[model samples]
Target: MDFKDYYETLGLERGATQDEVKRAYRKLARKFHPDVNKEPGAEEKFKEAGEAYEVLKDPEKRAAYDQLGANWQAGQDFRAPPDWNDGFEFSGGGYTEANEEDFSDFFETLFGRARAQGARQQSSRQFHAHGQDHYARITIDLKDAYEGATRTISLQAPEVDASGHVTLKTRSIRVNIPKGVTEGKHIRLAGQGTPGIGQGKPGDLYLEINFRDDGHYTAEGRDVYFDLPITPWEAAMGGKVKAPTPNGVVELKIPQNAHAGQKLRLKGRGIPGKSAGDLYAVLQIAVPPAKTDEDRKLYEQMARQMKFDPRAKLGV
Candidate 1:
């Protein structure tokens, strides 16, 4: 879908403050109110102004919007980046009466569903005790935990309609990633759940954060470990070698006489977090094959001359 310039929609700059956004929205809403304006599509424009205000007014929503950046022109093709929803949250199946079809793909893609019209009425219908809470699991990356990121997750929920028939609704929501939010910690979004019945509040929506596994990065607790195999010569000779981490590859110094399975620690190089974590490089000694006659002769000569017998302890 083409991107909508929310700032432009309200005739504000990309860096417009929340108060500026709120003021702009009010001016536009008054100027374009369907009831006050005779121009065609005034209602549509007014609605757009309202939607933009909703996002730009709230700190959480505004932060999420700012993440999208001002580089995207209005009507530009848009796609969410890896960790777009860093610190906001949503619960209900994306669209509701309060902010239904009036919202844009950009808004919906960035935030949670708005309260539907007559949500109050729906709640009054009362389904006995508060309905059971809903559950959703959102997959985040290990780096997200390292440095607390935001994410917009898509979810589909099953619910029964007024006719007692079950239906599925899809919603995409944004949630803040708290520091050290390890796998399985539920991020709860209040008032963003299914409506309750007869004096019962709506059920809550719980988001469980899960980390996506990386082939190169093995994340355990606050520590990261990687195995790097080097030629026996590199282990024996003190030198700088390239080592990989979640951030990227960096030069690591291996001291002379470093042994196989020796571990080197790089402080504060793991995932991003408050206390952060460390990166460890474990050495694996690689033995080259004696494929050439010269290579075979060298091993044979060393074996014959060296006084260091590996079996010296086991006299036979």
Candidate 2:
């Protein structure tokens, strides 16, 4: 994809302030508006100005774009960096602020398809008195993300009774947990939320995902990390040590002279799918106590044989 310099399109510097961007967009919009300027390519120029302003106007989109770095020139070939917006939050309601049809393919690739078609369809209706939307949280084990599972979530809300009086209601609904769902992701249940008023449709339920506190491994997005404990001998002499991953236990080679907290990457062993995440093994050395006389003698003999001072770097 060729990079589009939004700042250049608006005749402003890269560090232009918000007010400057707005002013430039307004001036360019007026100059190229098809109705005002009947010149050739005026309509295309007007569309270009709108696209530039569309991205620069939104703070979230602007920040994401700025992450591409400043070295890129206009019309330079570009590909989005891996996991560019990994933890960034966008709306789960499938509604976007921008008109999805107007933006170019580059915009869609950077920012996902905005403006859900269903949302547009719903807006054309004349129904008034819509139902109130509901939100709830659901937590599951990390394994549930690897292998999909069904979870029941309970929700409490106030609903109108037959007597025209509001009453508290508690209900439990079974939700299917899909594989590869990470933390902070949501599951939308349409028409399963609060009941509608009059002839209006029921609102949808948004269930936010949370992982249980499992001490075995730590997860960041799709990547997983676990500590691999090994003896000093294993660290000094590179050996294969069995390490635990989300999938199963696998032999991980400890590099010679491996120090504590040293990491080794197991590519594509994390959350399953295309573009899967990598699993990291952090090395931790565990020393055995010299309790027995034989053990003490062996440790003393090694101490006398080896003239190693760990604090030599500290000048102690």
Candidate 3:
């Protein structure tokens, strides 16, 4: 799909405020209205301005568009990012009507079906109801919870079409998962849900948060846990060993005679937040297998040299 720069269409910079966008749309509409200007392409320009307003004037659409980033040029071949709206919750409430023939393909690509249906419903009905709120769960990376990240989420919901029939439609949007968000928490995106019936206000979208389960790490509350595998020599020699934490790896000093299943705590190294949680590394000592003669000889020598009897207490 070829992308359209709605900001460019209105002769405004990407940073234009809502008021600036509204003002620009009005000015452009008046200057290029076919009935007033009658200039070549004036009608096209007018429709373009309206389409731009249709997106920029709404916060949710504007945000979704902005997530595509600012580097795209107008008319550039574009494809919607996969899972672009994965974590976002969008409610539908505000919409402006335009003839399907007036808007370009790009406009329809973004807001065509919903806007057309809402407009048609508004004209046909006197009573209106608020749009329905939508909810979904999104699974994020553990690292994202530590440092924050943006995710694309796809949502399938029932949408009313121009024929007055409801059909399930899939849409995508991008959302920012804030730092330190834990599982079961929610992110809210206002006006990114189902469009209201008639002239009613749109409902909000709520996204439940879930974190990916990583093999190396497990989290409970803000605390993070990991298993630290070490050699038998390293466990008994009292040396510094590199331990893995969510933030990164750090040298952990193992005391002489450190036992299996012992936990070592690194303060404030877990999930980041006020009163941050700790990272716990549980130690597991692994003994080398005696495969070669030399290794077996060493084991025998140790068995004879050291007074060790692990099963002595079992009275075997």
Candidate 4:
């Protein structure tokens, strides 16, 4: 998708404050409003101006957009980073005034999800008349998922100053990480969302769970997987070896003649549940480097004595 420079569309500078943004958008709207301008492309320009204003006017949306950095140029081929909005606290999904389809692809790519979510929240609120719920994503250690934990997390929401510049207002909350919680699971904190109108109750805050990439483990459903580095001798002569698990280190039995890429399952060792998931220790043969003369000699002796052809199965 092409990058749309919202500031440029509204004839404002990148550092323009909130008030400046509002004025520029108002001027553009008046100049190109379809009813006032009879030019062939005035209507399109009007729509573009509106789209730009839609994003630039909101502190949260503007702050999130600013994160793309100032290096990006207009019309450049662009794709938002996967975790661009991670940890950003947003209310009612940053609802937009118009249908998402009415905006350009650039706008939709940034705020479309928010618009859809806002629509759902709005629909529900019409009946319940509660405050809008907030949402955010919080990353926790994988061990926290295995063993329940209570952690204090900080979340930031954007606020606009009188000059229209965006600033982040941070708030800290204590959250309980339930044991066996899977990725994408949400922990709802009641009455933490936006304030309600009149006598309506405050909305909720939903925190989505994510695991940090610790470089040692990965999870799929209830199953956990990690590389268990084993020496070549261990692969050849199976015996007991120490292996690391989420809970702790445990002795694992390596069957005789275990090969690289072999998986050793530890039943009921994964994320705890009624039917607990298993942990898979994927074998990786670690070869010691022949840095010394003795090491080189030992390797040479093995190569000469083994006479094993690794590629024999390939029929080469």
The candidate scoring highest on TM-score is 4
Candidate 3, residue 4: lDDT: 93
Most lDDT-accurate candidate: 4
Any runs in candidate 1 off by more than 4 Å, and if so which? 1-131, 159-169, 178-180, 305-316
- Which pairs of residues collide in candidate 2? none
lDDT, candidate 2, equals 0.72
lDDT of 2 by residue, 16-78 (tens): 666677899999989998889999999888888888887776554565566576888988987
lDDT of 3 by residue, 1-316 (tens): 7899999999988777777888999999999998899879998889889988888887656765776789899999987754454444344345654566777777667655445445554454345586655555677788998999898877755434564333446688799999988877878888776677677777567787776767788889889888999998888788998876666779999999899999999998888898888889999888899999999999999989987898999999
Model 3's number of clashes is 15
For model 3, what is the error of residue 3's alpha carbon versus the real structure, in angstroms, after optimal superposition? 46
Model 2 residue 106 lDDT score: 77
Q: Which residues of candidate 3, in runs, are more than 4 Å off?
A: 1-129, 158-168
Clash count list over all predictions: 20, 0, 15, 1
Q: Supply candidate 1's per-residue lDDT for 235.
A: 85
Tens-digit lDDT track of model 4 for 217-269: 99998899999999988899999999889999999999999999999999999
Worst 10 residues of 3 by lDDT: 158-167
- As a whole number from 0 to 100, the lDDT of residue 130 in candidate 1 is 57
lDDT of 1 by residue, 1-316 (tens): 8787778999887656656776898899899998899899998898988887776665435555665767888888888774454323333322233455677777666564233312433464453455335455577887677667787777755433564333445678778887666666788777566676566777777777767766666666677888888887798787889987766789999989898889899998875567777888989989999999999998898778965575878995
